[model samples]
Target: MKCLKSLFPTLMICLIVFGCTNEDIDENTVNESSNKNYNSPNYPIKSTTELIVEYQSGFPERKKEDLRKKYNVKRYEKCDCTNSRIEKWEFDPRVDLEGRNELITQEGGIEGTDYQFFYDNENSTPGVSGSTAAGQSDLLISSYIKASNSGVTIAILDTGINLTRLPQSYPFLYGTNSDMTLCEEGEETEVSGWDFVNHDNDVYDDNGHGTVVTSIIIDKLFDEDISDYQILPVKAFNDLGKTTTFTLLCSYLYAVDKPSVSVINMSFGWYGPSGSLFPKFILENPDILHITSSGNDGINNDDNVHYPSSYTSNNILGIGSFSIKKRKEIVEPLPFDSRAMGISLLSPREIIKSTFSNFGVTSVDFLSVGDQVSFYDNNGNHYLVSGTSYAAPLVTAKAAMYYQNGHITPTAITEQLRLNGTLLAYYSLPIYYGDRIIE
Candidate 1:
């Protein structure tokens, strides 16, 4: 079966070559740019931050009106910052005063200069925590009760997954439309995937970030105790972790059509106000679930929540990270890590053991030990890596499990997370961790 699957790609290529003719090729050229629209609005206006503030403040609410009056806020139709408006008096003394003062002095918020604010204090070292290990077992046990991920398709809307790098234990998992029978030594499966970044189907990951995130959700399909799930790979980011709103919009559009895909996992984020391509998708398909990483910027927990996490809709699950050690010890909170809040869940993020950990890089810097390394291959080896990136998958995997068991709809899963998650009081604010408990 495996050998036959390997030959499938070769056979398909040969068929395509023989099936084509000069006229067919010319005809294809005419249809090639059919989807291109030069007049379409450029995605993710570079000045979205200012636009977001305006949109939010412009809402007809009594509170907003009061704030505007008190601050003497003036909405500049166009300001520096990409020809977008800036509200002159919309600042909050409680939240923005200190940061604003620093900005005026040009003394703080400088990317690398503000070490305490910019650095990821959580999981500064990476390795497997007891929570991840236990979570794996919990996934298996949950499978017996419901097979939570079975038949549920999750579209990983991030970087692409390298099917070749997956362990033999999970070889059945193929790329979009790719042949799954021949796990090794075969042409890459013909799995259908779109790259919003390059505007093509070559959604391969130059950086291993997407691969790691995908593994967290899809690992159940390979685990001996639980191998009954499906994952759809959707690439939206490039190697540098940068992606535009257009790419994300394209990815969401694609997932909306995939009947089996009920949930989408997004681990990347930026600073912007709510309302973007994601909300449009939710408004159209109220049943689908959208999960995003609460950003890593070390602001007050609630202050760092990034969109689509901040979108505050029924269909979105905003995820945060908590350090879980052996026997469920909660380590000191990391700086800049988003605090778990309404519709958010906190899971183990510190020092997670995965295939492509950052062991070598951190070890070279004397920040982590090599023994903490989990897996290694031609792809760069990794040690304990920590970020909201890892935390998003933990919640996504649990949601997949829940979906497989028929315990919740994709939208209901978001609500369940909030219901079951732990609530914490920090910095005089209450934050919620949707369903994932430390026990």
Candidate 2:
């Protein structure tokens, strides 16, 4: 039951055995014929009974009230971080939504339903044993890099963070006090992250995905001796790794509300029509760097889009996974002696694309070592997890290091990584800008 890094390659096998299936095909990936086909089988399933509507700037509150009364909204949740421009309205089930889509659009606004997004990785084994505290300490010491401390905060929107175990296990986080959590809801701060799933402030990682993802970011930052940095945990997903667009939007609003938050680490996504409010959220806030996983579906994202990662925002960096010592399929062989036929020769290729990692020439921005990454679960059990989910945090950590050196803008941080990263190519096509973070 010890930490098993060796099983990382077979992580996809575990997911398949566990019955991971693609139930939805996103809009970008769907054929033109399905554009007007709302009832198409490839359409993403709605996760909630709620509908999110974004109104025009300075929209009348009286009109909002009238619309609420007309639509029979049971209650509404604020989807805006700064203002009440966007709201998620929970309509009574008895109300007919036959023409709601068109009516809402005619009200000088756009509306969308919540779609479910899953955590990008799956566990290989059922259990492992170790004190997260000791394992983290060992990890820090082994990956230590000589550098000065810098105060850069990263906000993570995922299955929440392990509040109880994090304070005791990860030295970089706090359990209480002024540095507790940086949630800015209603001009008030909390002791821990805000949980959008249960409508509370308990940011505990029940599914362990958040903890493992957080560990990777912390590991990279700790390696550089960065002690002043802060991590804002925003729990958007539930324990079962199922989350809706409304929940994710709520999480995004909360994360962006904190002005101190410089980067957002989103390791979860979904395949859908790309009509969610998330794309607008990222576009509106260009100050923060958003790093997301491309996906684990081993498909070309250009053809079959993944949310957040496939989002064409300059501020967003979509990351995929790669591994060393992988035997890449040789489409064309290197120049060799004609007599040496059938004898393999050492190709210049040093890394191979992960079999399960999604990629696209324009969608994914970079690739990182996602296989066999050492991480600890929420229950203090060490493990070896693999996915584009883990790969993204590596880039996020590198971006943090760049931010430590005063690279504040997303464009600047991305440029710095590209300049220092290893350029990777496959056959003849260059996959991503910064092939991988050098560190």
Candidate 3:
């Protein structure tokens, strides 16, 4: 997601908890968190100060030995889980703030109509949280539930959620066990997540970035009965809102390894080649849909490549942001809203582009509102946020719903999503928005 530049003013006194959160903030500032643990010696807890070599699989064992002998390596292993042969030899990687979620949020408030779109009726009234992204797409689920997409899971690789803030009424979170100490591959109990920063099982958010982001994934709907849509939160960032490549790699590897997870929402990104390891896994695991923000950087991704976003893999869908403006227009016989609200609009809905959304004809796939969107914090306080960060998850939620309609695999979901997408005609865009999905 694009980094938020400022805060929306006018603090409303309600935590509206229906439909995906609505955001209309400046600089596209969406909240994101930061911590836990690797128990095995081969996969020792990753530290920014610690370094390793990212290599392809099948390099000679002797060559690795020579490198180890030359560098006097502290530890080395060819990781099999995340991706191909990675010669993880010890060195100083100089892990900095590069891995942190670029999402931005300032201390402030805002004034806007909190329009919460309900299950079938319009939740015109906003709650303690804020508005949702659900209505924006004209994409609301059925008044009932089905098992078409049952057993689907979404892995959120970010800071982590606030544990104490679990919902009492219903469950939007997954994993019963919180003990991350016995984090062995394919362990006995179902694992929620691990934090590479603090090297523990506590994936809870220390800074609230992860919590807000996770909320954006499932908490923005008025119909709170979205069962079987599970959230697996992984804390990849630290309290400083920063992380290392190694830490991110672990999170990605862990997420893909899970069979239940068909969709992965990555609202964070870096500027250059994130190595071939991630893309390699994505291709091999074509069943999983890996989606990421085109980046919050306000430059053309074509000219300035943003890794993951700039990747050429078919499984990866690079997303941009657009503040879906509701404009009044006059048709041949009647007047209409450009981006219609309330009941679902027809195919190829009116197109409006967000000035801050990053785009590339070759890289970007879709655009959602990346402006000031509203959501709940760890304390359930309602506030608006913006950025590509929020937009990615809004798309994720929609994709999960699509899977329920029988489009399951990455290939199927991607095509079906584009099939029903809202095509943007306002400008020459990289992403192809269709009429099938949104209407």
Q: Which candidate is the best by TM-score?
A: 2
Candidates' C-alpha lDDT:
0.42, 0.62, 0.52
lDDT string, candidate 2, 12-81, tens digits: 2100012222223222121111122222213346534467777776778888888888777798877433
Clashes of each: 27, 0, 63
Query: lDDT ranking from best to worst?
Result: 2, 3, 1
lDDT of 1 by residue, 1-439 (tens): 0000111111111100112111112111111112323222112334211112222323344554564454344442211112111222223324444344344333221111110111111211112111211111222212223223346677788766554343333332323332222111123222344455554434556556666666655553344244556666676766555564444554666666665677777776544334333565566676777776654443332443345565656666655554323223343443332544241213322222212211111010001111121333234443334455666676677666666667557555644544454432132212222213311
Clashes of 1: 27
For each candidate in turn, the TM-score is 0.50, 0.72, 0.64
Question: Please, what are the lDDT tens digits per residue for candidate 3 over residues 231-289?
Answer: 77777775545665555666787777665788888776655444545555567777877
Q: Which candidate should be chosen as best, given lDDT against the real structure? A: 2
Q: Which rank order by TM-score, best down to worst? A: 2, 3, 1
Runs in model 3 deviating more than 4 A are: 1-51, 54-67, 74-87, 91-150, 165-169, 176-191, 220-225, 326-351, 378-380, 427-439
Give candidate 1's error at residue 411 in angstroms.
4.4
